[model samples]
Target: MSYAYPRSTGASSLPSYTSVPSSKTTSESWHDLPNVAKQWMVEGAAVFQTARSQDRHDIRRFASLIFRRTFTIPSALILLWLFTLWRGERTVFQESIDACAWENWEKWPQGATPHRVAFIADPQLVDPHTYPGRPWPLSTLTVDYTDQYLRRSFSSIQNALIPDSVLFLGDLFDGGREWATSTTTSPEERYQKYTDSFWKKEYGRFMKIFLDPWMDQNELPIDGRGRRLIASLPGNHDLGFGHGIQEPVRDRFQAYFGQSNRVDVIGNHTFVSLDTVSLSAMDQVDPQTGGTSSVVNEAYPDPIWKQTNDFLNKMTYHRGRAEMGELRMMQNRSEGIQFDYRIVEPADSAIYSNDQDEPVDLPTILLTHVPLFRKPATPCGPLRERYPPSSTTEELEEDEPNSLSISGGYQYQNVLTPKISTEVVTKSGPNVVQVYSGDDHDYCELIHREFNGSPREITVKSLSWAMGVRHPGFLMTSLWNPINPETGESLQQGSSPTIQNHLCILPDQLGIFIHYGCILGLSILVLLLRSSFHVFFASEPALSNQSPVLPLSERRGDSYKHQYQTSGTSSSTLAPNGLASRASITAFPRYPVTKASHDAYRNLDQDDLVTTTSKDKGGYRPARPRGFRQKSVLMGREFVHSVRVVALVVLTVYFFLIWRW
Candidate 1:
């Protein structure tokens, strides 16, 4: 039989093997674990006899993550900027004003997946009357130079936009003449020809300038799709105004592109190419009100508004407000009626984009030549009124199309103009997300904060110079779809388009400031993280175990006992040297778990193994390393802290120097 001590204290606190009586109970023998497990249990029991204290707080470990990523992030940015330089894109911060818009292509937030569409409007490519030796009008885009400018615009588009295809809102041609003359053919024919010669330029030339069907093999659009034919909508200039537009122009224009009112269903999204010119043309009013019939008055009474209304009426998504009223307009305007029609109401009918007479469940995009209306700020603010409405006065003498008054009538309606245009889109379907138009040379993005669902109108800037008031440029929209929300791109499906409107104007020289702000913000974040991690490691609980050393086994002599005193405290010790002088040994060894083996012979029952028995109670002590270990730990921590301070100072100086430069 064998006797064992009570399992009240930790393994490290148990008396030596010789102290236990040589006797064992059947229960203890039957339940004894494997030697491996006893060894593990011994280590586990030692933990209770150890002392530890925690002075650090960790709330999710975010501090360590931030510190580790600091170097990684800056290095990546530097590499990307270097790549941009290699591509001749210029370092993002070093771009000239003219190149800002073009350079924006590379600077867009990385990993954003946008349905990059090339949005260019109002080419208005027609003969602007200047022949050889004639001074170029500030408002004019002469026929000869228009082609050269168009080439330049398209070239820029190819390089900058990287669009899948181009969308052209019309007035593609000024349509005021056929051949540019250096006194060609009979010199007398020019002076004698009717001013109606403006209408004589063939659509063939229009196609070459915009659609570019005859583009040389080398001049083909980069995609080799050959100047991706434009999805077009004719402006008033394309077909003129009122009931008497020259049919030959309409016939020639339609021959190249599809219908003036058409829809292209693309990947569950609908692009409606609408001839608002023709729709506005039908804005016929009651003859009694004295308002003359506008564009295609009676003869070509386009039922665009009505057709669209019938479709929306069939959709189940109507929010039902007086908003439906703008979808269709039926008024009584007699002959020369001129009243304060605060809102330009929609025509009595408008075209709808549908597939086989069914309402589209997909998002719809309305493309038109005449914008819903010009933004009010356009002609009111210092920056906006930069150019007053180019052609506020009507021109009817030549009986030919006047690109000015026919296309841009900025102050034409209510405060939020395009009041009716909004209705056409809203009533079209609850899914209507965007409406794009281009009659105005300036750019406007009217986000409908009041609308319940999506409805944002984007008026694209003119591709070429418009009276030279504002710079000539176009819009670049970078929008994301569902799978791309994580990339940080703006998701237009539920939000406004992630857009950047680039132009020839660059008054902002603060790109560097923005970059610096981002860097400083990150550096401060890294410092905070470093501090947290430093504190966390410093405050880690130390696992301290106390066990009786063999030399302290069962008081051999009074002299040895006299040298050391038992203080009942594991931390209390008397030492004249740097080394610990306690009879009990304490060690902090990391633990690794192992499976137990069921063997009992290894159990100690011999008196030779007997060591000192200790009596200790529960308490917590802050463990301090002794001897040279204490000095080394203090020196290491201070060295690391100093390095951190030096690094922070270096970064501060480096950034300050860069900013000052």
Candidate 2:
């Protein structure tokens, strides 16, 4: 008996082996085989090696093919998703503006004529270093982008609505505050620095971008004859410090925008642009000796008390210089200089006059930065007595009532009451005064009784331009003939004022569309990756058609045989008779059973035979081996196939959702 070991072949080839046995009784002798048998064993071993190498190569190739196919579909889908987002954004933006339709005059209040007015406010051009400059931290709300959107939106409104006039109300620039100069710098240097740095730099940019373009288009006479309809009022920010009360900055503003602060008629409507930056009487007062206490009846008692108390504590006597150029006080009697203009007379007298020597008798529309009479009885007139007398030296030492009753001694007693004695003034038997102001940055309409006993209506409309920081909107108004409510017909007096509040809601629908589209695209990508992972890696049942049965059986049997042959020889030994024997042996007998035997065992009445025989003479019987269980390879294959199917379904759903959105 002999056994032949497998010989090594080339690196790419497998080895061969053979085995033969001489005796059937002893298992050790059976393992020793003839040369032919040994040769066959060697050949079988080589075949197994070759088969295993080929199997590994096939597995690698299969994996590579699967990966390539899986990614191809996803890559194409992603490209399509991105393209959809781009197109969606563009379409939404363009279509949103086009969808808005202008309202017709007839559709408005009956007998009402549509008068479109453009309200522009708070250009708020900021210096990069001094103020919180443009390109604010908020997204899509940066100065450049916001300004561009505004310009386009304005153009749309103009083209679609065709406004009659454009009004610019205040705060065009961040104020000029000198860091190097003390609060007491010369008026000339202060004014010059403000004009050069802040006013010119910040506001200059605004003008070049918006105002200049507007002026160039509309400044020329319309239809070859009509007056240009662009008007501007000075804001405190533009007038530097001291709330536009300074003479130099005030004069400069008047020179640039216009010197006329009174009312003027424009196409049957009067427009009044007022300068509300003049100093109050208390602003010109001194708290110490009371020599310059020009505030006859100090309406603002809080500041008067603070200044009076401070002077008494310091034991200092001082006088205020009334005629001093550019040196004016605030209404609170705080020590500060005026910024822009001087009040040649009191604010009340400067505001109105009915004397033949004064300008009057116009259908007036008053435009001012600050609201008139922020508190009750604070209107320009006799209401001044409701407050205390100007700070006096004796009064400063003691706490006393700052308010006063009507007294004959004070000529300026009624200064805060009224400049005109009536509620309304009439020219040719019709009311001629209407007030228009912008400061609250919101729309309001107020009717108040004037000193002249006539009804005066004031319309306060706000135009906010600080883009996106707050409400970015404007007011659109129309003047229509009053209508009869019952019949819906025009009234005898055909014109009634109507206002429409318009706000820029979204950053041109295009921007919003683009933003959402990006979000949707990212979501799709996440879903696709997740599905691909589960399809390839999840453990599940396999499909029945995955692998051939014969190949799987052969491969599994070969692997087991190779493992046993490699490890079993080391545990075996040969005896003196040239036969292999184990040092210790144990065996357990098992009953040979078939399906027929099992049925007979369960049925007690079934005929059966039982016999006893010598252990050595027992006939060889077929035995069902213990510890052997069938594995469900078919089930595993089906599970894997199911996973792939599920992944495909999920991917389809994801793609459909994206398309719908």
Candidate 3:
């Protein structure tokens, strides 16, 4: 009879072969035909019986190993994914900033400082009203998920880029206008009720996502130059456009986010943020008659348009006053006069100052929600999605209806009219550097040669992923304005601050999910292959007649006896490598089971296979029970593995939860 050892142990434990004189050779035994086939089936059944006897221990060992790896590997991959991809915003944002490094055009002034401004456009925080057909739970989940994404992205920006100020170019909330209408139609009740209910909740959400993490309490942090932490304007979606504009909506927006029409002096340059939405409403035609309104002229009917008009008039008066003051100062200095005087302009100057022969020194960076007028066929750079107009006819339609709109709608307009565009650019003057606008939800850069000496107007892309664009992005601008020594303010006439803009695009979230899917598929494949290997190789050992089934003491010479004797313990107590032995009898050598082997062992009696023996009893003996130390060591190893698995699981959960909450 041949001995078969467990495959888990090495093949060196296999004993030397001992041939039986009457038995057929291992290669020739299979020629017995029917008799050999029957014997082979019997031997196969016996081998299965032997495996079944130890099946409980083997199953437990293999199952524990698989379970530990099942949790361990995936958990490790999840952590790696978060470290590299989920938090990869920092790396990408830094790379974008590096790409737009400032050039050494001239030496910077001592007082001049580089001010980095981060521009966030059209976040449009989602709500249930934004997507009516979606399930309520899904909508809520999306809102929470988007909030988390914004929070993480903002955190990355602060930690990595750390801009001096942030500018939000409108559309802060998706349902800002919706809330106004849904609360109440009456202008009187809408403001109070909207503030008390829906608006309050959304405002809280917005603050938590955008400001709370960085700012102190509710106060807007001001920098050394008196610039606030953030500057924002209202969008068509925020306060509505044209006839859709509600008085309460406008008032609430002003109360919360500050004046829609205002100017900021940063880095000695004028940033004129205008309420173009309300201003454009002046051109709104009566849908029924297609003409202007003429009712209630005494109080200047349609207060929405009147309010915007008043802001424009105030701006004109201020510009004229500033010009006259500068002119007076220059004349006084030239004449060696110390007295101060104020010059009063005639009433007609107020009406015609904007239409002057020489444009004012506005040197403005105009900010508006709606883009200025451009021909319907104007190319908005190669980055624009709808580019390279396929046909010349499609490119040159005067009333294409694809342009922001030829007219106005409920809450939006396509673009400002050519007349209004000329007015704004003319007032801003020939020194207008760049005009930035949003509400297009896509990146569009065009030159409006109609006014301001063809200033470049860039419509920033929306920052939210749900806004139709596949890739979301933000703009980073660096402004450097040198200060004059005589006056603490910026130089009146000199080289302007270098303004450089860089667009930083975020990764596609859907693509991240695809990567996760690949990881999962790979893990499952690994487990399947591992299980298959264990089944075919580890579980079944090879059965060969070349090795004899005998106890070491019975078959081996004095050399084997000397080794066991010198070990200071019996074969049961002492191990080859100082580990306690479990069995007193020698372990059997294993070989592949086949017909030849079966035929050889078929004639042997069951007593030929000696599993255990004791000298005192002089007969078969069962294996000894594991010692206390052995059991404790096994338990310790298992405990360590279990703890490792639990730790990985907890780490994976913690990373995912922290991002959401």
Candidate 4:
């Protein structure tokens, strides 16, 4: 027999068919109703009677089933849509260990051409604060999260089209001092502690996590023979506390990676890696049990404030027509310390045996940790008196004499003067000597004044390390053959003419496009997915109190069947008014279901239901069996609606994986 859902009336809600007064009905005519309709009525009647009986368990089950059929699929579809958008936009970064292959070297420009050198300074590998076994009290300079920044910078450099050699200038470690003792510990223990604690622990772990994989996948090599190769020069910290002394630190460095200072001839170029740190060491003294000290502190007796004042006075007045006399006098008097300015000329007789011992005449390059000059002469004005007299004086006095100013101040005389000798090599023709130094943890390029005349023309370029301050990124240099002047042929060692200044062109468009597109796309995808899920699940109203507002066609057949009961005697057929009423009700207008109406039904109480039915004709209806065919049809519709949602969840997961990669 066909079943129908219960309907609401003005007086009291119509009892379900099951609850209707049952007298033995023998009317064959009533059975003429469609089986689907008959079945619906029976299910609805059962639910209505159970609900009327105040059976909490049955009512709860019916409510839950309806809520699931109504809301679950729609929610799933929304989630799926959000996931798709997320997946489409996400960027997937692939990690590879061996990116640089031997075959990639074939792309390098042919012939022995003077290459551009990029100097990276002051990487400061270990973060002192987190480092194990570090001495108590750390410097104010807190380490930034530089490891990630350097890895990305390296990726950028690798993606760039230019071929280059990298020179790492000094301070490769935060401080060379360590806890391993040679006398008390075994040699292996000492080595293990040194490598594990310093290199493998802090910086090495970072490399393994992010950088090494990048380099391997990109095919960039670190060896000398590899394209875009790298090498290093010792800085003050790299040398530990020893200046001129060949301490254990120096020996350990040599043991690990050959000599600390060496000169390499690449093509027609001479790359001189000087131990600028050693020069500073010559003036340093061991603060703990001070002997004659490793390096002499010439400015020891004189306060730094007074010395800086005198130096500023010389620079301000020596070449200027302007009277900086008042400025110099004010600087001296500003700090009550007496000034004893020593004209600390280079210990030339001691540093170099002969006055005219000229540096090698090849196209030379100098690599050191500190800049040669304190400040380049600026046209706007010399920085000689740039700092207000009081601040400058106080800062200088606070700094140690032999130590190079980590931030603002001047290099010691020893560090400055030796570099001047190196600059002289740049002056000779067809020769361009570029000085590459690190220790500043930033990228900059400066030129020798006499060689190219202007900063733009000068060959010098400075680079910050992959370990220190993170922004602006790491720099790479490429050296290649210069085209011939006369024949337009690249100069060969034997047959071709020498050319000057091989230009470093930036990377091609394809590399840049791929790198940036992936990064931006992935970021957008992640954001969209997160927002969609939040909007749908977090903001939606509850579903239970809401009513299913069906069309008149749906309501009439079910409602009429539920209200009527069969009354009969055997073998007789009779027509009933119920059929006519069902027909008429089916003809009524239909209204669309809304979220607000649905919420109202979901929150309806038994008492509210009684009131609502009396007030609104469409407000109440008998529930159907939890597993009725009508319920099954609703569930099928829900399943169809939820396909989009299921798909979206899958896509979101996929995109999340892509982002991780």
Candidate 5:
């Protein structure tokens, strides 16, 4: 005898299956169904029925089955690894770096290697003390998370690009200048507090975030020498801009991050890092006198402005000396004379070369915190955002105010004054190929018409997500000026180095959060639905009020197996409806059978016996009402589903926390 599923007879509305032909075997009947029907059969029977069920599967059995299936197919493990480890912080950061392709330094002339510098700007690490109105815990979390982000960014840069150097255009701390300036007590005590707070407390955080041990600066080589970390320019946030600058804050920042004004020579190029913030203060009206102080006048003594002016004068002298030395070396090389490689310019030597009345354009890269002066309506390039001009001009007129109005409040200035900017460009030398600055906290690229050569200036975007812009980014630059290996002089005179700049933008963190939030919500909903698949057959409307006929012996035995011994009958014969006399009729376990129903069924007429059961005779029972036990089972199922959903959420959070790790 073969067993097959029965056709649906109108009593069930949940779902119906077509009956398998009784003449065919179970496997043969299933194989005979059309492919399209087969697909519908699996979907309708398995998925729909499971989804429609009101009861849950047994927890232990379900978990065991899943555990076994995992060994055969590791898709669950693979998905977990994909979401957690593969697509994490390193990948996100490296992908952004990759998007901005590096200039092919390998293809350049062999003698002088090109210098690759990664520019990081305006990290402006959040300090909780800066905002008193916010909750302390939230502020702490913001600080921690920002630090982690920077750590990952720095780590990824070290691993992926491995630049010859990393330049930190300032705004290193949000509260660096504010620390000791607050008036709470005597100057001595306040100064001590500032030292303890900044050097002792915040210093650790700064080092941990930006200077991971693995990112040892010396690991990368430039022109056969170790690399350098240039953090010269002090930000307004670090030492306060213009007249608001405090001596103590300036001293501490200089002590830690190096002098605000300095020069670095690498790979036949000059990097002039100027303290424009201090220089802008030179013309402010003196409180002692009604007249403004002049930076050019040697006797006009305002100590802060005086120091920066003296530095500029000294740099101008150095630029003149370097130019004269290089010119003399070039002349000597032509005549085939062995000249001293050590460059020294005597006081009598001419600063100007005989070839041109205009000063020779030097290959220099100027780094500053405040950008050089520009008109308010000047159009920053395509990547510029936040109040961009409606239309753009390719060039700004030279006669227009080469200076922006020196308007500023507490700790910042909009731009350097025209006089200070001119001083910087002149002292920085005639051919400043590029100028990089930060403080606007967004991307801006425009030509400085006042600077010799009208070189491009890029105001790098901030690295912190907390900064107002939607996309935060950094700049990658490659400077290649090939030089003779023996003399260390430029092989091509009168030409500036090949400087290429590319901006690599980071992923939008807000958008990432929204994406993860959607995934979390959808996951919980799917898990809840999956937990409802165990009671479909029992809960069906057709099965609820109807009594299914069962063979007498099997009904009495309450088992799958049976023998024909009904009411002492001896003959074993077919039941005439093509069923074995002793064969069993299937009934759901949910409908219980009792001894009293046997006698009730025996007395009923044949037609009524199978189709209907009298309530008074008690042959067939309706599905039992949901009780305390059934409700408890449902509660347990809900609890398990909740647990699975919570696990997914926790995993997501954990992935973020250990992303860099």
Candidate 6:
């Protein structure tokens, strides 16, 4: 049966990326080799022509080059072999280690459905209260760059990309106490909630300022079928400061935007948007004493993290259980498709069309604002790093895995959760192919590098350049399937979905010219140095007995006869007097006196020049074989040069490959 994809919008004219053709490393073909490489071969051919001359010295010069090449070719081959190996630190995101079949994309079937999703991180929306003469210094906190550039870029992305879904890896609010009045601006007032009028104003302001694309101007859902799917998870900011998750903030967030943690099922796939703050809000172990603690007794604990563990556990089991009917029901509940204002019911006919067959297990892509992998303690975001208590206090807490930071310093580490998320990931088995996270507001893709296997972590750029950080862009992901040509159905059961992550550049406050300019300048310097060295060596004089050129390619046609015979049988042709006759010889020439060839011969001294037309005379004679002693002497010299060639080759390989290995 044929297939249909949801809301596949085609462009009028796709942007052309074909300028100055070059391919990526993983995708390069043999055809991509440059035309300049062929020109180099021809240039080398024009330099060698004197081997066809009557001079036997030129023939020896050509032999010496051959001797050098024995070393040169082997050395180049060793360097080329070394270039194929990646000598960098081990990364689990390598295609060799990834658990999914995405590396084998070519083997998959064609015409599969492509699902596009855009990931944004840490808008950190700062909407200060406009109360008249507020006691607090809210007006002093002026960050104009975040206000101007970030909001404009998000609007640009929404209009330009028009993705199927937008996962806001949240830290959406700067200080999320909009409802609190001016009178109660103290630290204690952080937990206090205002009247209903305050919440209405807060929601309205947020929609207009930050999230206009997801809804209409009238504060209603847009009925453009398969329109923008909005999913957001709480960052530490969404809760109050010092891991403060107030009841009012949590309740209002759910009332407006569905849930803090949500599962979205689009077609056959499932995407989980998790509240990382809720999961990691409570520290299970005490820093002072090496013992387990409850949320109430813990130094930093709350109701958010306590319920988050239980909520995630139930949800994990609800989806993973093998029973088909209940599993389908769980997926349908999270289905993002809509007929009108509300989500389609579980009994909807359209939902059952493709899912008519017994429900089979599929991949689950997980997203968390706080990464499972702990990041470096170096500060990059707007959240300034003060002295953290656990980091400074030299306490009796026991050492843990590599995930938890045990360093006694000023920087604090985000400790491990109750292992609920890990358990869910482990129980999901092969279905969990990839995990993405954000809170750091810096781009980092890490892998667990487990003995069995692990998925990749793709952390994205923040929307704002708050702390003058480097990266500021959202991730665009394309999820597609391998469609079987014969059956026309996607090969989703055994295969993994193809995910392509693209980092779309937003405006950077600091330009990239300096970074790229240095690289370009270095490349030019290297090229100039190489060319200068080549010319320097080529202009130098040849060795005392060597020829200026060698006719390396035309060796078979040309013949050389030495004027003085060294062989025993050729002694009759030698001068009777024992004075060595001037080494006069006839040559069967390969290089005639053409303009190009004449210039090469013009460099020779008058004594070295040939007066007679050797080609017209046709007086070519082969020299007789030398005596055993003479032959042995020639063999000894050849053997010595060969040994030198082998020595150079060994040295070259040792320097290039052995050191790296």
Clashes of each: 35, 65, 12, 47, 0, 5
Q: Against the correct fold, how does model 5 do in TM-score? A: 0.65
The number of residue pairs in model 6 that clash at the backbone is 5
What TM-score does prediction 2 earn? 0.42
lDDT of 1 by residue, 143-222 (tens): 54455455545654555444545667766655322222233221135533424333444455565555542233234333
lDDT of each: 0.44, 0.39, 0.59, 0.39, 0.63, 0.47
Clashing residue pairs for model 6: 49-550, 50-549, 50-550, 51-550, 240-244
Worst 10 residues of 2 by lDDT: 317-326
lDDT of 2 by residue, 1-661 (tens): 8665654332222232333333555545434446556456567776787899899999999998787767654445455545554444334434433443435222564334444455565545434322333355643344544455456545554554455666766655444322112223324453333334444454455656566546545533221213344445655455542221444555555555664243343323445454443322233334343544333335534332232223222211111121111011112232343334756445433422222222222233445554444223222221122233345434232222322222212111211223211211222113334545444443433345542323343323232234222324454444332333233233435334333433222233344546556755664555445443432343332212111112211122222211111122224344676443443121223221223333323332212222222234222211211211111222233334434544465456545543433
Ten residues in sequence with the least summed lDDT for candidate 6: 539-548
lDDT of 6 by residue, 164-225 (tens): 66777766765554445334331445334454456566556557645775542222212111
- Say which prediction, candidate 2 or candidate 5, comes out ahead on TM-score: 5
Best by lDDT: 5
User: What TM-score, computed on C-alpha atoms, does each candidate reach?
Assistant: 0.41, 0.42, 0.61, 0.42, 0.65, 0.45
In candidate 4, which residue ranges exceed 4 Å CA deviation? Answer: 1-122, 126-149, 159-164, 179-228, 241-246, 284-360, 376-432, 450-470, 476-661
lDDT of 3 by residue, 1-661 (tens): 6854333122122223323235457334434335545455445655676788689779998999788756654355555555554444344445644443433232445555666677888889887557857886888887876776677666556655666677888888886876753344434332344434677788888888888655632322222443345545888888887667777778887888888877665544567778888777667774544565323255445556667666665665555444433443434442322343545445523322232322135456888888898876566654554343344455443323223334456678868878678767776544788888888887777677666456788888787777887667777777765544234344536655457677767655545547656755664554444333322233222222122223333222322211222122322444556554444333333222234333333333334433333344243332211344432333334334434544466457646655544
Predicted candidate 4 versus true structure: per-residue lDDT over 49-104, tens digit per residue: 77777778778889997887666434544454454434332211111112222233
Instruction: Kindly report which residue stretches of model 5 are placed more than 4 angstroms away from their true locations once superposed.
Output: 1-64, 67-90, 101-112, 129-132, 181-195, 213-218, 287-291, 295-302, 320-361, 385-407, 484-489, 493-497, 528-640, 644-660
Clashes of 4: 47
Better of 3 and 5 by lDDT: 5
- Model 3 vs. true fold: TM: 0.61
Segments of candidate 3 deviating more than 4 angstroms: 1-112, 181-196, 213-224, 230-232, 287-290, 293-300, 319-362, 385-409, 483-498, 528-539, 542-657
